[model samples]
Target: MPLDTNRLEPVLPWLKFRGPDDRGIWSDRHIQLGHTRLAILDLSPLGHQPMSFQDGRYWITFNGEIYNYLELRAELVQAGYQFTSKSDTEVLLAAYAHWGTGCLEKLRGMFAFAIWDRKINQLFLARDRFGEKPLYYWIDQGTFYFASELKALLALLPHTPELDPIAVDLYFHYQYVPEPLTPLQGVRKLPAAHFMTLQLDSWKVDLSQYWSLAQIQPLEGNISELIRAELERAIDLSLRSDVPVGIALSGGLDSGTIVALAAPKYKKVLHAFSVGYPGSPPCDEREQARSLANQLGLPFHDVELHTEALVEFFPELMKALDDPIADIAAYGHFAVMRLAAEQGIKVMLSGVGGDELFWGYDWMIEAHHMTQQKQRQNSISAIATTLGKLAHIPIYEKFAVTPKLPKPVRSLLVQGLNAHLIDNEHPNQFVFYNLRQDFRSPWYHRRSLYSQEFLTQLPERNPFHPSVGNDAAWSDITTHLCQVLFNTWLVSNCLALGDRTSMASSLEVRLPLLDYKLAETVIGLQKQYPNEFRNKKAWLKQAVQDILPAEILNRPKRGFEPPYASWIQALLDRYKDSVVSGSLVQSSFLNRNYLVKLFQKPYNNYALVYRVLVLDTWLQNIR
Candidate 1:
């Protein structure tokens, strides 16, 4: 059966890729719609997605790289599987024909693909472990609609799902609504490392997990040597692309390491890109990146984002994002990728997964101490109450009283002091447990939004099990840090932002650090090499010590920081009447007073500005 022309047209408009220039969707009239993509690998027309195999018994629309395709292709070749072209797409189809659902277990890369097994009369959708790629689906009126982006799925449905206010609340708190829930009520993001198979006739979906980080065996070897070997292997695999590839270098350890690894592998000098605002504290690292690039004998391109450029790109940037996220750094990422795209770099590597792979965040250490201190006695609440009386003293003064304690003990004392300050803070009288404080929307006050039953059920659904035992600091690295990185930072900041920003520029960005096998291997040996993650990627630094320069190796982790607040201020000042008087804040969904307060106090409030700006832009365009 040929695909329906009408249904295919709608999917074409949603495509963000530009390489090879084939954009079309395939819909089997009443049954299915398949979208074809042209990624970095397999540039031939035969390698295009929606590839049919087994005499048209199977069809697949795949996204992402399969690093182990060569190995899988070898095994399938021996199993009498013939290929038309050197493509992972054909390899995937043939592998699925031979192994069925078991083929998902054999895949070792970041991917989100949908395979319609015509013989089985079922459609299978799967996402990579750690959700490095995205797959969104919505069911409506006995019809199944799926896409790499929620907007495409929405386009297929007859009507959009009502805005999920609870999800909005979660967005303000976590900057992103975690899996199983989306901004729209009826849509859902497929969980990572899991697959969903739907019966065509009945339209019934069954989901199952194919892989888990918890299942990996702890590697017993010299930790530094193992890290070096695994990281090199992963980097080499990710660099397999026909088009010219570049690295998104932040003078940080992760990107620096990537540049050092990739520079020697490619035939020509690798192009490196970075983004920053002039005179900004975060922008100080651009010189360091340039110096490293010079030493590596590569061309360094710095995308200097001004307030004017940010304002110019703000509206489109908002529309490019899948959801209204408060990740301010995303602006800088998008700008750099846009510049990279203009420079004709099709594929680029990012330092996204490094922080999560290693215990590189302050919160990871803080959470470890908090989990341990809670066990000493549930005295946090009492200590917080006592510290409330010392509100007259500065926070450092309060901390001074608790000096001479162990590292963990000191962390707990700091936590207690901070909690006390929040509990007894001045002005708004709002108490905040999390760093984010903009979740005080009127919608949050609704009984249905935060039901007691939902709260009670949340503990069970908590991704990291409390009983997993965080007795050792290494447990923090393996469990809490890994969970936070995967479930929060990587999902929200790295992958989500990377996909949107890169795709917005029609560039494919890859993360070797987020490799599933590499993550699993690192997590398993976390406890064995406790000191490695202590100073955040200490082991990774040691492993690449020889390859990377001393300056690059010892450089502090400065994340991609965009000048959103400054940009917003400038925009508001320049186009104050248009923005404020426009439908953005005037919409009933958001409070005008709160929006005004946001502009009044924009320091460290880039999230607030981003959320409001994106929401405003979305509302203006969509409504």
Candidate 2:
């Protein structure tokens, strides 16, 4: 696959951040394959990508490490496949040559790659199971384009891509565009666990799902032991890298668990990086991260975040993200990744997926509690509705036994009054509703800040329409809601931020908790013993109880976010005019008057302020 001088011109900017080593391009009239090497594995010319097999039947331009390459290479070796170099790229090519699409099921680790099957004149694209990596594609006027970043794919186009209105709608709803939808129209995400095949001549497309997290069921064994074994195995496999690997350590249970497990097998100093804010509240995890690092005999590295730094680097943060994500926490990840890269570390494992897998979010508990109260209220409401229809009584007349209840429960009941019959509503739907309304700050609360035209144009989209499965929990609704949050919130928003920010520094961030095997184990444990899924990450806590100190395990949930209040205030103090008078407001995507009011008033919700400012910064930098 020689570099086409024409295509190369537009793609050079993308190569600047990633391809520090030799760049390889394999191009012909029919197809073009390009790669920028980071040289993590088999750091030699042989590891150069756009790699092909001896017969040149399959060619791949891949990003990410195959931690199981050695094991896969061993199996391929016995099957009589010869390798020219000890590169995962070669193992990947050989495995594909032998097993075809079946090879994906046998591999582990984060990856997004395009394989050109010259034998069939087709292109096959696949992403890892948990979307630890992102692959975006656009189909335009008979041409198919895909890239690791939207900016990379945009480089190949002539004119600027328009902002997708629906995506902008979702960005305001969830602070990020939900997957299968990018900010640009015509572009779509290659969702995790899915694959696509394109016929070269006809340009016909076929997409398929190769794996499903819903395949989980109750396992017949001690739940804690099973989780411990599965997770330890994932860590073992993830730590198999040629270059030094580091840990994105924090005070939380997840990263602490990874460090405890990998400390023995890492075979190096086990460098850990943490982010802190200068003179801020006790939110920063520097001291806690340092304590854990000391207990584990690992070296600790950290960077202190300053408000001015976040304000000045605002646009670069959006550029690093390649898309707008309203999460202020991404800044923390960016700092740690930068620190790791500066120390010459290429690979790092993060503890990101545990919450999604083992039900670690605060909303999970809150949703369950709300659901219990709703069950009691609905029981009374259902009887009243029946009486109202039979006796011409008002629906609320008798139901007004009017017991005083908590505000959260009363608010949900009021919202559900005019709602359609939810008699058959799945537990997951209820969970999704409770979480979305309770956890998410929808724009209806800030409708005054939106233009009337924008309000009318806002599509009535339910972001939680995707299924996470509806069985095995006490009710189908419970687990279904959990899975929705896992996919929509964790994988798409959280993991997307992790990939973009880390890759912006040419650093690879791995998640052992997202290991399909480990995820399956947690889901199975919940299904098998539904009653025991009571505590947040309870199984996880028990699994590593012997390794993690009690203090670390008992610490309250401090999520992966720096002190954003002061940071947003600092940013607003410097750029309030720039945002209030910026394109986002002037274009009517936001209300100029409301923004000015927000700036002038003593706004308490600094997070909401940060989100809009981030949006404005992105709108400006994108051009």
Candidate 3:
């Protein structure tokens, strides 16, 4: 049971890009902690991690910027606490020493850190409110191991971890594995807004939640003013860094809002970075971004992502992601960060959470109304509606449904076309809303695409209910849907992509809109004015209208999107062999015949094809 220093060596190599500034390891009787520091707040040796406090009663290794540390330090000082260094790491230790786990409530900005309480012989770990940072942990044969990246954790494990069947099934359905479950058997991610404690004496672990979107209640005030004030404050705090900060500018309102509010307040010349395609295709936003930068008088830098570059780096991008997520926007995210890194920018601000926080996506509202209509149906009405859909499908199929209609739209039309469909009010009903078209279909439908062997391997339970629990009230369906989006797509897909791609370049990306306080204000405002949210970012636009240019404000919303149709075809052409006889088929997780057909006409079934390719490519790369 003695601590093994050698076990920590392999992980550092895998995570060196995330924290290249410094490296340290600390160990005692049965404990060893390792850290590689990026050194954003304090670049001195005093800011090194595996940092200790109170003559070593508490030692800590932290990742992420505590933007509000200065404010917290003053409060801690008033409570008779003192610090040796100006680093947030010291303030974090002192905060924990004084407040225990209560310290999580007082801290702001993104973070994932652990405190080793030598006095109690206990170890404590916590992730930020929105999971802006990553933490993966595994337990085996009485040993607990954790790291910032899954590959790092894999290197530290005693043996090779097997692919988790349930995780694979969920990944196929959701395009990414939801939290508390990773792709490997026996390995899990710590959920966001949560903390854990492990006592060395008994080796017992306790996990608890510190925050939830559901905890926010409706606020009463000038809603626009409240939101504007919170946003400015959040951006102001985000700009508090010793290193140079840049903005991930885009053509849309979200990034424009950040630039409008942040450029003036930034202490030095604020740089703007953007990514576009070679042809200046309609999807490219570089021109808009360049115009904005010119108007603001900020230096602008942009990169063109040729298809060849994306194809060449596809495998490395998959590996850098560390988790097999099928999102195509990752290429853009990686390019922008790499551009920023090249400019010597250590930290960047992004506008990621706007769509999820406000009612930005119009389809979200449609999904909410559709669920309500289904809930209000009586058996007779349900039967009539089901039959109407069935009757129209043949007629619509003959004339309307083309071979290239995109499988998602087809799946959406055919979803819930089975018996006992009236009882679809379960949280699983919202799966289609989040782009998981075939997740909750009847067994007959699943059997067509997934192999019987794979179907049998899956447990007889709803995969989504674990993450999207049915505890929230269905009456407030919109809020419930928003919460589900946050828990599922927003965290696993959007935030995960941001953290992984940015950190791959060893740069820190901060999302001011995702600040917990700003999120709470928006959610609370939604509760008070539910009708206002249905109008799609009405309050958000109003709050930032004065600062945002009218053209930028009114421009349609298309976030850092790539030309998916072309990119997917290019990826398919490059990795088609994987789909024809790849990991999913060879392992009997997907039916070979179905996969062959899907691959034959990739356009029709691009979603499923993309997921299969990503998984197969990932399995191959890791091996």
Please give the clash total of every predicted structure, in order: 0, 7, 0
Cα TM-score per model: 0.85, 0.89, 0.93
lDDT of 1 by residue, 1-623 (tens): 34345774665577645223565455553555556465677787878767889888888888887888989999999999899898888988888889988998888787888888777688888998878778888876666778887777777777767666556556555666767678777888898888998897777779998876656666677777877888888888988888888889888899988888888888755799987677756545688878888888999898777787767776777778776666667778887898888888888899888877776876555555544444343333766656433422334433444655576756655555555534422222222223222432212222332334334423222211212333342334345446644765578556887888888787888898887667776777775555544547787888888978787777677867555556667766654445454554353345455455555644345554555555556556544
Error of 2 at 315 (Å): 1.6
lDDT of each: 0.68, 0.76, 0.82
Candidate 2 Cα misplacement greater than 4 A, ranges = 1-5, 368-428, 433-440, 445-447, 461-475
Return whichever of 1 and 3 wins on TM-score. 3
lDDT of 3 at 511: 99
- Pairing residues by index, what is the TM-score of model 3? 0.93
* For every candidate, C-alpha RMSD to the true structure in Å: 6.1, 5.0, 3.4
Mind giving the per-residue lDDT tens digits that candidate 2 earns over 1-623?
33344685558568657657778778766778777887888987899878988678888999887888999999999999888998898998888888988989998878889999887899999988878778889887767778888888878776667767677767766778788888777878998888899998888999888876556667668888999999889999888777889999987899999999999988787899998877756898889889989988998999988888888787788888987888888888998999999998988889987777777778666666655454444344564344323321223321322556565544444444322222224333343432443123444344666767677777764443233233353354455656667667886788999988888888888899988888777777777777767567888999999999998888877756777667777778888889999978776777788788878747655656666787788878767
Q: Write the per-residue lDDT of candidate 3 for residues 466-528, one digit (tens) a residue.
A: 334353645566677777788778888899999999999999999999998998898888788
RMSD of 2: 5.0
Show model 3 residue runs off by greater than 4 Å: 378-382, 385-445, 462-472
